[model samples]
Target chain A: MTTQEPTNAENWAKPVDSLHIAHDLPDHAINLNVEGKRVASMTSGFGKMWQKTYRVRLDGARVAPQQVVKVWKEHFPEFWQKGQHFFGPMASISPGDVALINVKTGGVKLSTGILVLYADDVSFSFMTPEGHMFTGMITFSARELEDGVTQAEIVALVRAQDPIYELGMMTMGSGAEDRQWLHVLRSLAAHFGVEGKPTLEKICVDRKRQWKRFGNVRRSAAIRTVFYSVTRPLRRKEKTRASA
Target chain B: MDFSADVRQIDGLAVIDLHGEIMAGADDALTSGFVRATTGNTGPVLLNFADVSYINSTGIALIVGLLAEARASDRRILVSGLTDHYKDIFEITRISDFVTMCDDEESAAAAAKA
Candidate 1:
């Protein structure tokens, strides 16, 4: 094949030097941890890297890849189960947009955020920030197979960001993450009036952990989110006085 | 689209000749080529991107996976022939931090030797 560059190749999200949370939106339980942190790549993580894929074959729905992607991007938050919140400024995913996420787990609320890393017609991806549970990227895509079946898939290439996160993953963190996506796919399939049975495939891409990244614990979101939750009443009192 | 990688040795450096669009289904082939590139060598591996016409974010992540492998084995990776646009993507992802960038194969190979 010749080496001609793609003409008007689809628009990808622009590169960002770091993460900055948009503060114009209404304050929520998960908004505190994301305001000033920089996005973290897989190399910034402290644990072994793993790639987990969750896919649902949308057979009998006759949905094209573009259609699936269109709906997925526009209504991403609606598909999540109750109590898992995702708020993005744009109606669709774009490069450099930041999405705030607050997930409830183990009777505690965990606040974190994602930076929109890339977006195109058929796919989009998010990169995690420092202090998030996973430091890596999650790509959601829809494509038609050779057999003419359209499949929607989410691939998470992640590693724990610190020792605390690694321990959480070993205990219940990974399971919670898995169930959330499962709920999302099922909900999406249901919206299209198709029964979606998603299958999971996990691969341990790298076995060695970066012990040097143990310092990541200093920026742990879980710990900081807890602090914010504890100090919420004081903030509310201050706001009341300013209003008076 | 299909992606293929051909690994060739030049003065103890491995140069992977990459071709085609990089996206969802190209993971296995790239890994196979990377394994071949590192065999019987402890020196640097330089990727020849002269023929690579496109790369998505997933493709970038795939390259990061390879870089992680290279780092684990204590070998540096280099890239040559990336158009300015994709080179910008590398800068955005901060992948340029771990891998050395060059304009062409000759310069990359020279850097590998030095």
Candidate 2:
């Protein structure tokens, strides 16, 4: 890790102000924001998909892409166990350029994808199982907010699409997918040490409310079916009894 | 392919100790050992992993299958002596929530008795 500040040119090429969009045919688009500013956005056309976004501020300095990859591999070896290889060559990373890896492989049926972002003051990534590909972005910037602590905001916008989302709809309700997204966010926060703060707590609570709303809908449907079964026969019996 | 087992009649617990790497081709032996421990035994079983070196996904599936069988038969199954690396992997997959963890053979045996 280097403590040196990123040069002006490096920052300008991958500008802090502009948004970069990347998408392949039939894949999802990814959108990212840097320092609370939109930097990149991408969108994909896959039916029923999964998306995850994560951001974190590092205290020491920016770590190189290789080092970041090394750390990730160490922490998540099982991810590599399924034979998903790392994309691009390792030597292509320049001084300030962040490396992005889109993993596509493993587990059950659908093709899973993982996107990794490595930067000086922040690192984030998203992982999804098959049929669910994530499209999201991460931005890194620093500002002097308080005297000592720096204010770093990492926001993740994720959605479940495709089979899992559809399965959730069939089994758990529409909001079930949203609850899964909440778990993804919490897991990302835990990985980056961004959890336990008041803001994150509020975010989780909001997700919980969505889950409960969908749960209520499912419960009501179940109750309606039970009620219909119990009343239909009774009405017929009463009519017969009156005719008799 | 190293496997050992000791059946304690008083406690009605079977402790099976496995060693070496557990991968795809070697799962049958492991599965057989687990079956031997549980068959005709109406009590709990504890898998002692103190000597085990590594386990792949297939190995994990075998263990889960054994646990499922034990549960179906109203018998409890506990896993004892996991290394930190194994523990971390299990935690990531949420497998620890499904299986009981014990510190040693004695604790596993005692818990099985209860």
Candidate 3:
């Protein structure tokens, strides 16, 4: 993160910053669940860490890696699964931009956000905030295959922040995540008018859950967002004041 | 583009001296360095990043993969020579929670010995 060091590294990643204080939401984003939370990485969560990769082959497409990525970044939200919304800043993909997200896992509606951890011509990555369901980084990349085709991929290195998320993932939650990213890749491929069958690979990086981080459950976005939603009437004034 | 790892063992601990930036292309060198360090040694591994100049998010993921490999075999990995800034990255990523940090190789090795 040092400016004096490798320019390549600095170009790829922004200086690490933790979100400690709440900030006023932009007109495009919601303020719940993300304010006052720090960015959570793989090590911050309570569950066993996992490395999941979901990829699709954009066969018959003649797009270069950089071009695919350009389109991906420019229309990032368009590729997401239905019911999932990503609200980024007005500017294009760059280091340090935050994305306000509203997503659904199975039937549960969750509000959360992510930080743009790294970006370049061919790939970009997002890291979750502390209260988010997945605490780690998910990288999206478009690369040229050996056959001159483009392959769009999503690699998620994450751990569930708390027991709630871990349990949810164990049940239908994991599949939901898988489906979400698969849908994204397919949508990206469809943009090129190519049919894609995204493949998935998942690995458990660590099996022992850190019991010490059990307290993270208190910050679970699912619970917090639900609380925020149900009690909207009570906080309407505060919300209005913050906007003012 | 030029990354290297020099490994030396003390009291069954492997101390890896890393040089250059750890980014996407440093994979082979980093993984091979681990292989060399643990091929004959059974104790913990201590990474000395004093000479390392930079690391990107992908580089961080590669290290997490290494940690996963280490944990699978019951190997403890310690770290030393992380700049305050890089140390903060480790903390933000939560890798610090698993790996013990020491100011220098001597302490990391001794801690491993303990």
Per-residue lDDT for A1-244 in model 3, tens only?
1223444444443445564222334573446676556777566688888999999988988888898888888888888887788877654777667778888895777889887777888888888888898788888887777777889888898888999999999987899999989998888889999999999999898898878889999888999878877887879888999999
lDDT of 2 at B70: 58
Local distance difference test, each candidate: 0.83, 0.40, 0.81
**Where in model 1 is the C-alpha error above 4 Å?**
A1-10, A106-108, A237-244
Per-residue alpha-carbon lDDT of candidate 3 for residues B32-93, written as tens digits (9 for 90 to 100): 99999999677889988988888877788889888877876878999998876677667766
lDDT tens digits by residue: candidate 2, A1-244: 1122222212112222321223222233121111122212222112222222232333333334334333443343222323332232243322222222322212112222232332332222322221232222222122333344333333333322333333444354434323433443344335445452312321210111122122222222223333554686898899999999
Residue B64 lDDT, candidate 3, scale 0-100: 84
Alpha-carbon DockQ of candidate 1: 0.45
The recovered share of true contacts, given per candidate in order, is 0.31, 0.00, 0.31
What TM value does the first chain of each candidate achieve?
Answer: 0.90, 0.30, 0.88
lDDT, candidate 1, at A121? 82
Q: What TM-score would you report for chain A in candidate 3?
A: 0.88
- Model 3 achieves a DockQ score of 0.39
**Candidate 2 docking class:** incorrect
Best by TM-score: 1
Give the root-mean-square deviation of each candidate in angstroms: 2.7, 21.6, 3.9
Off by over 4 Å in 2: A1-27, A30-244, B1-10
